[model samples]
Structure formats: C-alpha cells, structure tokens
Target chain A: MIIDQNKIDETIKIIKANGGHGIQKCVQCGACSAICPGVKAGFPLLCRALIKDLLNGLLEENIENSSSWGCQACNRCTEVCPQGVRPQEVVFAFRRYQANELAFSTSAVTSQMNLYETGHAVFTDPKEARRKVGLPEETPTSAFNEAAQQEIRTLMDNSPMGELGLF
Target chain B: MEQIGLYLGCNIPLKNPDIEQSFRKIFPALDVQPVDLEGAGCCPAWGTAPSFDLNTWCAISSRNITIAEEKNVDIMTGCNSCFGVLSEAKHFLETPATRTAVNNSLAKINREYKGTSDIYHVAHVLHKKIGLTKIRENLKYKLDGLKIAVQTGCHTLWPSDVYKVKEDNPYFPTMLKELCEVTGATVCHYSRLEGCCGMGGMRSTDAEKSLKLFKEKLLSIKEETNADMIVTTCSSCFMQFDMSQPILKGRGVIDFEPIPTFYYTQLLALAMGFDPQQVACISQIDRNPIIAEIQSDTRRIKEGM
Candidate 1:
C-alpha cells in the first residue's frame, strides 16, 4: 500500500478526537501484540504493526482479517504496556469503527441473526435451559423452513451441556 | 421493615438455585425483604451495549430498576453482572441529560425509569446495609483459624474511580478482607488484587483468554498467599476461579493446590454455623477440600467421646 501522509494525519486526528491517547508514545515494541490473547489464537495481528500501518496511511477500515473478533477485551496489554498505550482500547475502537464505519460483522452475529429469525436463539426452547444443555431437540420454528437451521440451534444450545455431562 | 427489590437475573432460577435460596435465608435476619421482579431477562452485559452504548444499557437496566421502584425498595442483585449493569444505569441516571436520554430510549420498551431505585451488589447488602458487626452476633460457627483470599471480581471494581470506595480498595483487597474478618478468618494478601478476571469479556465465547487469566490468578493465589480457600461475591468470578481454574490446571499451565471458591454468602453462612450442606455444598467448582474440612471439623466437634 502506498503511504499517504494526509490519510495517516486524518486517522490520527479522528482517533485522538475519540479519546484515544498514547498514539505517539508507542516505541515499536511488540509487547501489546505479544501479550494479546487474540494473536495467540492464530490471528495475524500486532498492535505495533497496526500503529505502523496507521502512521504510514495504510490503515484499513475492515479489520476482519486481523482476528478482530478474537479479542477477549482483557486489557492485559493496557496494564502491562511500558509506554502506557492502551492497545486493548484501540482494538475496541477498531471494532467500533468496523461495526459503525466499515459495516463489518462478526461470527457472533450469525447466532444473533438465528435468534432474530426465531423467537428464541435456538430452535428448541427446551422450556428449561438444563434440558437444552442435555442435547434435547431444538423447538421447531416456523420462521425459517429449514430443518438444518433448527438443528443448528439445538446443537448450539446443547453445546454448553458438555460441562453438565462432564465432557 | 427494610425492603429491597430482588433482581434474580437468569442464573438463580435455571442454573444456580442456591444463590437465591441463600439470599432468602440470610436477608430476613438483617431486616431486608427482597421483592421479586418478574419478566426480567439477561442484562446483555456486552451484548446490547457497547461501552459508549449507554442509552441501550440504560433502557435494559432501567426496566429492572422500574420494577424495583414499583416495590418502593432499593434493588438488590444476586448476580454481580446484573448488579454492575443496574448500578451503571443508576449512575448514569444520576445525571440529568443522561437520565433524559435513557428515559427517552425506554419509550420503545414502554417503560420510563425515574431513577428512583438504588442498585446494590449482594456483598453491599450483607457488608454495608446489614453491617458485619451485627452479622457477627449471629454466628453459629467460627472460622477463626481459616485463612481466606477474597477475589473481588472485575465489574464490581472496574471504573474504580467511580464505583469503588477507598475503604474497600479493590486495588488492595481490603473490602472482602474486612468482610471475612467479621467472621473471624485471617485474610491472605496476594498480588493482582485489582486486576480484571478474564471471565468478564464474553469468555463464554472465548475460553482461552478466560483460561489464561484463571491460570495466572491461580498461580498468584498459591505463590502470594497461604490461603486455605479463595472466595468471591460475584457468581461469574466464582465460576471462573472454581471451574476454569481446574481446567487450566488440567492443561498444565500452572500446578498448585486447587483452592476452593466460595460465594461471600456461603463463607458468611459457614462462619455463622450453617452447615456447609446448608450453604449448598456440591455445586462448588473445586469442591474437595473445603467440604471435607468442614465435615471433619463438624464430626470432630460432634464426637466428643
């Protein structure tokens, strides 16, 4: 990506306006990315790299490729960063940007969409959550005529039962 | 004739029944009447609201508050996440413009919150309203020799500048310690006293982060304090420390004695001479030693022959 001084300046200006501090305090150390639980889970993202890209005007609105949903929002880096930069908050801000500005969605939205289609998030209400945990059949929904979607709902609800069943 | 609205959230009715049971057992002695609010759902912690989505959070939180206001009592929560959400709404409504915005948003839900109710964590009810001094008078048992490490959970302490008190010092592990002291237990000091538990951030969706945080905290508890057990007032924190800690140990991230996690009420009840069974024994995450220890102590005391 070609570096654009104007774009970098604009991004910095906007982020700072939104209460993001420590932009200039980054010393190129990768501690924020290293300590991030997201990167540990196969997300090719690093805070230092993002900062460098932002400084070089190569920042993209879509961060879906960067393990954005992988963030646990733990703020460990914010606590441990020597430069006092809050990369955790930055990642959150990026998520906001993606959701609000870039219009990117997360995998979590699939379950939410499934819920919107059905009265309950899962196909089977199971009446009691405990029954749902025990792998009961999902309550059939007239919303989506697909039996597979209903089964998916049942399976999702039953997934937590692994703990109940000692799996 | 003190009254408080009960916001049970979802866990008590479905998954964890003992919390509500314990609350009912203990509240009457302290003059607290917990009224039930029907039609309440999850607070949606991070689901319905972003950090800046204060308006949505207020509407959801206010629905419960409105229910409490109808009963004309302060709102008391059995779940820590519910307490945090309701408290945040209450805190936001304390401001005029924010109150107006929240009330305006609730028009969709056909509810208007007047900001009349006070939301409190169960710990606040027991430690603040009931006052430990008075609770101490009811003790049927004494945990005089037990060493406890109080795990003050994240949401309870975060935004510490606003939510936390100097006396409690979430950053220093004092409030929980003080509560334990009322029951006559020695508090073990440990590092990371003010840190967030990894469980708070949708750890249900992502387990590794929760596991990492739990592992680190378990190691800290073992290395820093010679505590016989770890206790917390938050249900999620209890679940993480008690349940996730063992999973992490199984993963071999840390090797230490799996300290049992107890709810603040359970600890208080145990010290007050309620049998561990009455405190709801088997549901605990790391259940082995604490129950055994209490059982052996009770047996020893009974067999005076």
Candidate 2:
C-alpha cells in the first residue's frame, strides 16, 4: 500500500512501454471493473484493480497474480470505459511484464508450448473429429502443414518471445 | 464463385469440426463459397502470442490474415477469439510503427500484411454480408415451435472500434436473434443474453470457475426463457455451451436436463435440409431430439410440397 514515487513512475513507464499508452487517461471510474467478467469470476487483479495497482506502482509487487490470465480479451472493458482508457490493453501490458518475468501461470506455459509445437495454442487432434464430421481427416490448417508450422515457428522464434526461450 | 477465405482457428477444425462442416454447407448454400485458407494457424489465441508481446500477437495473427490478403479476399471465422484477435491485429498493424514491427516477423516467413483483408466473423457475414432475407429465402426447413435462446458471446460484441462490421447496437445485439428467427425459431430473450459465457482465457486458467460462470449464464437461459435449445455464432461459445452442461449436471450443479446447443451455421445447415449427422450431431450433449424435431419439420415441408 506504500506509494513510492519512483516505483509508481516505473510502473507507469513499463506498462506504457508495453502498449498501454492510455494508462494515464484513467479517471479511476469503476466502469471497466463493473463490467469485467474476470473480476466477477473472482480473479481480482483486472481492469480497474489492476490498473489501480499499476498506476500506484505495484507492478513488481503483484507479478505472480494469475488474474491477468483470466482476461477473456473480450474488450468489454474497452467498450464501457468512459475515459477511453482501454483497460484491457493495460491488463495485457501488465501481462506482458508478467510473462517476461517468467511468472507465467501454469496454464500459460502449456499453451505457449502448444503454439511452438503446433502453431495453435489450443490444439487437439482433429483427425477423429474431422472424420466423424464427414470431412477430410486433416484440416487445411497450419496444424497439419509442417512447412507452414515451421514458418510460424521461425516467426515466433525471431520475436521477443523467442528471446525469453519459452518456446 | 463469390467466396471468402475461411479462417478455421484451432478449435473449430480440431476440437469441433462439426461447426466447420456446418459452415462449409451453410455458406455455399447461401451462394458464398467458404474458400479454404490452407496453412492458416491459430488466431495465435489471446493467451498464447498476445500474452507475450503486442507485436508478437499482431505478427502471428498477421501471418494468418496475410494468407487471406494474398487470396484477395477477406477472412471469416466462427471462432470469436479468431474474429476478435484477427481484427485487433489488423487494427494495430494499421499503425506505422506496429505494422513495421509485425511485418518484420511476417517478413521472415515471406508474408507481408498490407492490411487489405478485413476480418469477418460468421455472425457478421451471415447477417450483414449474406442478408437475412437471402437466408430466409434459401431455407428448406423452418424451425417452427422451437423456442431458442441466443448467446452472442464476448469477442464479436466488444471493442467495436477494431471491427469493420458494426452491429446496430452492440450492447443489446439483435443480429443473431434475427438470424435465428429467419429459420422460424423464436429466439427467446433471457436475462443474461449479453453476459459473458466465461470461456477463452478464464476457461484455460480455471476450469471449474469457468464452468460455474457458464452455469450461471446457462441457468439464466433455462430459468428465465425455458429455451428448447441454445445457439451461438462464436465457435468458442458454441463449444462452451456444447461441452459445459454435462459437467454442470454431473457435478449436481444444475438439476435441469441440459439444453442441446448449436453454432448458428449448424442450425442453419439443418434448416436448409442438410443431413443432421453431417452438420449438427457431434455435440457432447445429445442433440438428437432437436435434430429430430428439425428433420420432422423438413418432412412436413416436403410432404406439403
């Protein structure tokens, strides 16, 4: 709860650097949280609360909070915000910081690995399902195309995420 | 051959290909070819690439969209996450800086996103692109006497600024309801019609909590509207509704028998007289009763003819 000026400035700077350009536009209105499904689902640090903490210099202090992972990326927070803060962007920005810190929620690591392996984070074997549905056993997607997936892997491998070695 | 690139994200083609199969049948029946964008990957789903870096998210999604851009057609998907994430990537990539960075990653793959291809969800394509009148005219069966509840889901509704297809009013959306009604089904209004289904990020993070959130929404659809079935436009919402009920019931979370669910295309394909097993019969929850009801309507129409 201690408001360190240096920490607060660093917090604002990090989030803005991570694509939360509208961080300072927030007027502290609770409209974003009022409509945030993540908060209602009991993951406390999202939208208003997460923004409040980030604005108050609690970024590193709340690194391990899994609430950011609960964001549906529905952009409902962006829709209802009066200040045009786009609170969802702020949440994602903090999530970028968290991911960089290697504080990934257990589920995130699995999905990231899936992306690296199959080019789809939420992949499943579609052979049986596609067959059952009377379609070709393999979908015409990157999941089955090794060359395309290799291209995807190269793209991810060259990105900032590759630098983290999470893949 | 009027066509659009069919962007099948992770779930539809892999987990629930029935929705993919239905889309294939429905769009072509309406005279719009669902062209396959081969080699397209995930929307890079929110939790994966998007969580790591903004440009990484845009780049991975851009790779998928660039496939459509190369085909010189916009993209359409049933997955709301695909719709939302792809649109967000397009919007972000419009900026000079973000576009430069994302295109850098894409350049390594020999693809450059010129931001030409717009992202379209199946809901938008059906209502706005195909037109309700066109849909109604082509239907071979009408779903009379079937009371339905529609879940529009989150991604297709929100942050409207990024989407090219604008709803008349995103908050109280009427497009999905109208699309359903054209097939002669009454889309009953429920209290939580616009509420989140608690899928996507929440589902991956905490399965049980996500189920509870979905249960709350399902209970609203049941207690308030007493709908005969649930229909949604988003693949993720369709999956959550299709997969969650048995879990909710098995855990004794709800005492009512679960309602069968469909992605809009699956139901639309049935209304157009496609075979049930091919288009609508692959849900975790049993949909035989609803499919039978729809098939009987088909028989009556055929007999009257």
lDDT of 2 at B133: 93
lDDT of 1 by residue, A64-148 (tens): 5434455555454665678877775565555444444434434445434433244122233323542323322222222222542
For candidate 1, the TM-score is 0.71
Report lDDT (CA) for all predictions: 0.59, 0.87
Model 1 chain B: lowest-lDDT 10 consecutive positions: B296-305
Q: What is each candidate's DockQ, to 2 decimals? A: 0.10, 0.84
Q: Chain A vs. true chain A, TM-score per candidate?
A: 0.60, 0.94
- TM-score of every candidate: 0.71, 0.97
Give the winner by TM-score.
Answer: 2
- Which runs in model 2 stand beyond 4 Å of their true positions? B297-299, B302-305
Stretches off by above 4 angstroms in model 1 are A1-62, A65-93, A100-107, A110-167, B51-53, B94-98, B164-168, B202-206, B275-278, B282-289, B295-305
